[model samples]
Target chain A: MDLHLGRITWFQGGRDKVAREEVKSLEVYETGPTLTFSMGPQHPGTGHFRMVITVVGDIVVRCDPDPGFVHRGEEKMCEYKTWITNIPHLERPAILDAAGMTYPYVLAVERLMGVEPPERAKYLRVIMAELQRICSHLYWLGLMGVFAGHATMYMWCFGDREYLVDLTQLIGGQRITHSYFVPGGVRNDAPSKVPRELVKNFRTYYRMMLGKDYPSGEVPEDFRKYVLAVCDFFDTRLDEYYPMLLDSPIFIYRTKGIGVLKREDAISLGVVGPVLRGSGVKSDTRIDEPYDAYPYIKFNVPTMDGCDSYSRMMVGYYEMKESVRIIKQAVEQMPEGPVKLKQHPVTIKVPAGEVFASAEAARGQCSFYIRSDGTDKPYRVKICSPSFRNLIAMPYLIKDVRIADIPIIYWSLNYWPVECDR
Target chain B: MSLSKAEEILKRLIEDLRSRFGDRVLEVNVEPKKIVKILVALECIKDVAQYLKSEWAIDYIKGVTGVDLSKLPNNAQEALEIIYHVGSLSSEALKGITISLSTKVSISNPVMPSLTGIWKGAEMHEREVYEMLGVSFEGHPDLRRLLLPEFWSDGPPLRKNYMVPGREGQSG
Candidate 1:
């Protein structure tokens, strides 16, 4: 019943398993119905996850996501720096989700210290969060397409994502980690033309043939025709990608019912965001726990009942639709105002208390807890990133998925290892 | 549905906690916009968390952080304190209550109970605490060096006393 396994699996100069003596003593639990395989940290499907997923023959029997690979000790560093300096430190996780990351921290600090941002500042925060949401969803779409082997979708989405990145750069002077949203408000007001430019860009890209016109019209008519013929092809592609893998007859045979997270188990594990919603729970920190402008905005939380890799993809796609709704509402109801509040002393001394702030990040619900002692610096700052929480569900989810399907399952979950480890 | 009702529910729940476990609920500090800091005796952390989650339906825990009150040493007994911010997405009442559990552990043994059992979200927070502040959790399932490679020898990166080798004496 007991077996010994050894580290250092290779022989110095040959293609032989040198740790044979170690393997002989291994306590091989009745190999169950399959062989267990570890998937990440270095695997491409995980992107930055650096997670180690164990599978029992194509089915993920367990997923142990070892994050902290990218932990830069951001919170610890925050205690030593001024409040203003900490914004950039916290925004590093998913640089694509900058608004989601920084907004909560700003809100929490603002609340604790007794400062309400100007109305203009509130509107600007709403606008920036919506823009960041679009940018993040686009990035996920690109990754989703790449995982499905639809190289075209991946390329097109990234190419479109550049526009938003440029918009971010124009506003905050940084393409990715725009530490633009400060405690009182944002760093500065956006250029007046930015909103009009946004409408123009969205109108052009979300329509027919206009997107095809980009990049010197190099795209062939056949591609354009292919895109237009399907009418709702852009929308349908989400569902289509999964079944392609599932019913390839060849591919589906490899990836059906893999990494299944039963509905009840998902909730009990406290798994959040898409992983929870993918398992049919309608839990959204944005809707359930509305913060900032979210209470005034309107959007629906999307959930799927399938509770598998397929369901995970569906959740992201449906959520993308909802994000579009949020952005539209934000833009329509956006009242003219200042983006950030009047500048105060750069070095802010927080009250001697603790504040916990959460926001609906692309990964899930990302949170930051700060404990201050009425000083310019915090006594301790802790970050509870969503990727960290969702990663725990991996071991439970990947029980019986195929080795090839590992990438599919991982991407569908939108696992960002840097955020998780951090 | 109103914000005041949420505040009332939290106060009532904390009152019940004070009755069941006296003295442990040190101070129920509420700051309207910012945070609701519930100061508690370290030993009654689980009892308080159980009340918050089960009785008040405070299901989501926003974040877990530690504050070293080395500056307020004259007024406080403990050198370091752990804080929990529990949020509820389901319950309209008790939307935000950051319950603070400050147990005075010796600077040598700055240990606290892990809340990952109730929230499942505190796993990484606890690991980070272990790595950065060198504060050990009594019941953490898997506590290992996170972020920095296991071999890096810069002791507890976040402690107020921790000094970066190259950056020493560069205080702002």
Candidate 2:
């Protein structure tokens, strides 16, 4: 048996290394460098994800990602449920990117049945998707910060994330699994004051952090002092974190040259969204393959040629900022229209054909390939998740990096185990 | 970039494949249908896939879906048919294709050739098939349970024989 990293690859020859080598020699071209080791099914910093790693000395020789540990078999289960019922079903893959994942599934169904959502609904989906993007990046930043041992950043990122989660709950009446996105449109429109609340929350969050002289007259002195202290702590931590991560010799040494996936390699591997962009390939499903309201939005697809863990991490940071920009654009361009298409309940019958729809999910491009036999329910639904493709590239990336940097590399990838394992 | 050129190219390629491998080419009707269905025999899966990749640059293996045909089986020995939906990233015009292949193995003890050797993307999909359908891949390196845990004794839950009801917290 050949074990790569901590994940099992191929149990080839019997327990004899010599026999394995002899057999391996016959398949000369396919013979990858012999590196043997275990990474994890459970380990801190790998997030909820753990992969057994194998390295030939300092280089990753092979990586086999052990999935199914968190497998819920979401696709098969969706088959048993009605079209409307599966709204919650699709959201479970990446809890942070619920709306982004759900939107494509909804769009595929709607597109198949030729159902058009109202103008307000389109604007609403964009708002929710962008909000979800921000929230997803916050989770990634928090996880990345925690893995980097920056507890302060983790707390701040997650704390700031709560503000957005609160906004989501206000819109959908739920936080994480906001089954708000349904076929044809959103399940419910945001309340008239909901936008006001959203703007207020953004102001409160921004004033607490980004403002120079944060409206001190608007609040009491003691409360002002407390906010200042919390802000100071996070501001100081952010100041130290960037230089420590990007400029420090030790940190740079670990991240600078680790997990290098080139541009062509990324594209050919079907590595989508930011992972491909991080490798200097300006390929975003939103920009290159525009869908939803993204075609109207203007944002740069950030790219870096470094292709290492640090580059990937930097890519995420910049992309998060871009997502914010998108949200702001979407909000500013909001127009007056009904938020949902008028339709009879249980009357949607999708055409008897498979529709492959993809969206720019936070991690990468998550593509949903749905097969419907002209029915309300899908004949078969196959989700080609971003993490699955990104996970496959681990062997190539983690080849020679030290076991100590394994968690760091994995964290920098921003991989979700549930997403990958699904 | 003209329509006829693409069609002519496909026509010439089909003729070559038909001549090279006789009746093994079950069907090669590649008209611009909604779903690009390429029906081929079990034995010619690897060959036809290579042809698709080399000639058409159908590189991206989009999704692998397994259909349980045990109830519709004319023979008990007939294996479940698996569909490999291949997508080409480079070809903007021709985005995705559905290639259906069938093999008759056994219901009691099912086994099929592993396509992981040809399409590296099918590794997870094959593991899924093995776990859900009980169709063992002959030369698959790691043929363990995928979605289900190692302890779960429920025999290949997706099989027609198995009664997979609406269980609580079963991911729905």
Candidate 3:
């Protein structure tokens, strides 16, 4: 048997026309060069996002992250809703860090309304925001671990996150999408008395989870013990978590040098949160633009110079510890007063002005630019979410990376599709 | 940093901008410390933005918002106002400062120079603005529909005149 490869020539007009000869050449190849495919919009790796990637063999040559699957016309819809009602809607975008996400909008609206929350309210806001930050970071860590094929890490992070979530529920009535932030202050104060047994159990379980101990007699009585226990639990977990991931050869090999974003490129790409800090940029809105009780509380901004996936994961780990420290400090320094202002949520009118308020959220700098035209509702509200800013880095980091490394690189940026789409 | 320090730096930056642009700078409002809103001509936005980035190191764009000014009394010309929230990460002193460079384009013909060339971060933002407000960024590399679908035939949804489906008969 004879097999013909490459081009096949067919004669046109057959045997009838002997004098006229026509050739139709059809070209075929045994091997193709590159394949272009869509990875998301429904894929487990990408949540509510579609990325079209051109891959040559196993290496991704180009990647285009198509977001907006969850776009609910949030900015446009804010104009139709009252300022206070917008909080619940806004928090839905970044559900994991509900307090942190809504804090900036409240701050901006408060600035426009020329109303300042009381000292106690500000401190409460800080505590709630920090707790939400820890919860958000844990969610990211669990998702990251699961994406990287470490099922145990996911279980541990998600299990540990419940303590923080429970604390948030104690402060705010809801678990996620807590519309706790109001224009002037938070919705409610911490319950007059949190069950001491619950706090003690959280402390004990968290300590055992990480195999560490806290100094006795250092923690004060009352609510301080609960806050201190949270701090101690996270502090111990950071040590254990960091060593487990960083020391593991497999983890190191998969993440250490992969998805490297240079410090300059990180800034240019508008990378934020752990992704930015991982690239050695010490820019945190909490420190740079101090709001609420951030100025009063003292906590280190964890940064790593590695500019890689490993460093980004490390930043997330250290940040959880820092968030616990911030919560503890805020709790210790909290003043005694009313948590909410006299202003009603439904009828609050803001003067005609524009205010850009930013809060250092778990993901990054979540900012709200509100323009009030002397109305109860906002004229225009622009939310520059951290996930939206980090979307720019997707194509840049994924270039020339292996298909297997896609999940690690994507999750390392901590890109939340819902938030970005909003 | 204290408000006074931020104000002083902002004052210095405004003075620099005034000297550089002269009459081209329409208005400068620095009432809110750490936020300087500069209203400039459409043509000079690129020059002003390039100066801010190269000289003061305002590297990243926090956001680009397009405000429909048809209903507002301040915008008598019935123009669409584009605001660029420019920020910095390189300089510690300027990190807190958010210089919002705003420019107005006539409602009939809304077109302005794109800042994507100066700051690559503004690429998606410009696209969003382009799709939402129907304002064209002249030199934008990819000024296509960002959030909205290609099949979307209605005018810019964020514009004041663009009525929602259920609220078509209602008056503003």
Worst 10 residues of 1 chain A by lDDT: A7-16
Q: Which parts of model 2 have CA positions greater than 4 angstroms off?
A: A1-40, A53-63, A194-204, A211-251, A343-351, A374-376, B1-35, B69-79, B90-112, B138-142, B165-172
Ranking by DockQ: 1, 3, 2
Q: What is each candidate's DockQ, to 2 decimals?
A: 0.30, 0.18, 0.29
Every candidate's chain B TM-score: 0.85, 0.73, 0.94
Q: lDDT tens digits, residues B1-172, model 2?
A: 3456655655665677678777886765452423345556767777777777777676665556665655432333245656776656566544323333333445644656786666666666677776676676767766555556434545566665665665644322
- Give the top-scoring candidate (lDDT): 3
For model 1, residues A40-141, the per-residue Cα lDDT tens digits are 456677765454445554555655555655666666567568887888878887788888888778877887777777766675676567667667776776
Candidate 3 chain A worst ten-residue window by lDDT: A18-27
Where model 1 places Cα greater than 4 Å from the true spot, the runs are: A1-40, A53-62, A194-256, A348-351, B51-59, B71-78, B88-104, B113-121, B170-172
Error of 2 at A300 (Å): 2.8
Least lDDT summed over 10 consecutive residues: which range in candidate 1 chain B? B94-103
The docking category that best describes candidate 2 is: incorrect
Order of the predicted models by lDDT, top scorer first: 3, 2, 1
DockQ of 1: 0.30
What clash count goes with each model? 28, 17, 1
- Chain A accuracy of model 3 expressed as TM-score: 0.88
